[model samples]
Target: MDLFFTIVAAFTIFWFTWTYLKSKGKPPSPPGPRGLPLVGSLPFLRPDLHSYFAELASTYGPVVKLQLGSKLGILVTSPSAARQVLKDQDTVFANRDVPMTAKVLTGGRDIAWNPYGPEWRMLRKVCVIKMLSNATLDKAYALRRREVRETVGYLYNKAGSPVNVGEQMFLTILNVVTNMLWGGTVEGEARASLGAEFRQVISETTELLGMPNISDFFPALAPLDLQGAVKRMKKPMDKLNAIIESIIEQRLKKEKESGSSSAVEFKDFVQFLLQLKDEEDSKTPLTMDHIKALLLDMVVGGTDTSSNSIEFTMAEIINKPELENPLVAIPTPRLMDPTLYK
Candidate 1:
């Protein structure tokens, strides 16, 4: 037992020393707050990530390198630095370092996490040209108008009463997206149930995505799920996956019953994807899994971003009387308005 302990201690020291020496020889990494051993800067991470990054940028240069456990986090603060990475050297920086939770959600198949290659290019083309082209957006304008009208009517009914602006906007955007995807197929009781379920899961998902997971920083420790972040994230993701699967099954059933003659009547994104899947294509043949993953991206991305923007804009208008009457009002820069003041 004494010999075994000595051997373990020696091995540990040797590994640390070797790693330290190897890193020492490399070109100097960007400056940031010093981190503790093994866990790195995780313990020092603040709840306000944006503010923390800002502080780091102020202390360091525009580009700050943070030691996040076994992973390296590069923070780009300046617009020029960001442009360089995103445009000047796009191909080199195209690949993403996907987290454990994201991998579980997408199976590393979705365009967001997929590596820079033919598959990603194909997926990008499908999304840009076929799904979200100008023609498709023009056709879907009516659906968006209908959902917006419904929301306006609801707000009008509750005129004086207090309303949860964010919640309402989220639901409105969610329905608009659903209608565009499948012509608002899930309706009445099922729609209510689905909306509630989706809201809960999406909230959980976004929270989990932002969290600092140990598994994300350390790949070898992912299977162990030390912080249980991956496990927690998977629950909501699985529920979402099941919902997508059920929708796909119902669509398939309808298609089978309706036959090929009704194929031309297909209107929604799901129908379009299904049709594409059936068509003989040698390059980047669409699969059902890919369809589901893309749908997940649409729901998660579309709802949160649009709803949040609307909510923020509404809040700004309500809180600031200067912008209350925008058409005739002069733009006075508020201390809070970073863009205008800066």
Candidate 2:
């Protein structure tokens, strides 16, 4: 028995060494900083990832390779390298690196995370051509106008007080989007309440989305959720799901009561989506899960982009006051109207 065990150990060592030596014939990989054994460069990562990447690019040239735990990350800094990946060979790089928390939040049904295929093509068509087309935007202009007016009124009311521009913009945009989505089905106070709830959940959801999850890097350890990012995301996901489910249920009930052909009023995005779903197009069937996922995508995606842009602009303006030296447009009392920036 001892002799057999020794032989097995010796054979394993020999096989490993042989495999390592054989791999040495291959071309060398991209240059990158050496990292630790298991965690790789994770422990050394900074909160400001962009700056860190820029620093690394200075050392490793245009393309820097990184081993993030069990995952491999290639950082392309040069414009040519970026174009190569994003434009020249877009099809090859079309798929996204979906985060574990996002999968749970979207239930693996959203366009942002769904693999590029027939389903993705369908979602893109529905979202771009059907729902958010120029004609659709024109139809929803009233909602946008109303929300902007309300925001102006809010700012006017809070005149002379220190107002949080970002927070206000986020709320206004959220209101406009929600109204465009299913505002017709959900009215006044309920709509406002729902917006508030959505704001909280969206904030939580986006923050979780940005967090680095260990499970994402190490797939084998996904079930463990060592970072607790997935666990933290569940509360927001559940709350958002409940809100959406309730709205969908109400919409369905209304449809049943009013009859299918009742053209009572203006249809929102939700109504249009449900109408498409009922058609049951075999090519790309739109399920309730898809609707919910898309809605989540809109709420989270829309608010984050707009609000963050506004906040960053505001920060730049305030932090670098010299930029407003007559050359740059300065914010003043007369410029109270947010529309002026537009």
lDDT of 2 by residue, 145-204 (tens): 777777677677788999878777787888777777886523467755766666678888
How accurate locally, in lDDT, is each candidate?
Answer: 0.81, 0.82
Write model 1 residue lDDT over 1-342, tens digit each, in one string. Answer: 999999988987986897689789699888877776677788888888899989989998899988888888899999999999999999999998888888788887898888998888877887897678898888888877766666676676687999988777888788888877876635566766767678779988988877777778888988899988888988998899988888888888888888852456646888877887888484778887788888888899998878779889989888897888863455644422433212
User: What TM-score does model 1 achieve against the real structure?
Assistant: 0.85
Clashing pairs in 1: none
- Stretches of candidate 1 off by over 4 Å are 1-16, 185-193, 321-342
How far in Å is the alpha carbon of 196 misplaced in model 1? 2.5
| Cα distance off (Å), candidate 2, residue 2 | 22
Q: Top model by lDDT, which number?
A: 2
User: Candidate 1 at 211: error in angstroms?
Assistant: 1.7
Instruction: Estimate the TM-score for candidate 2.
Output: 0.85
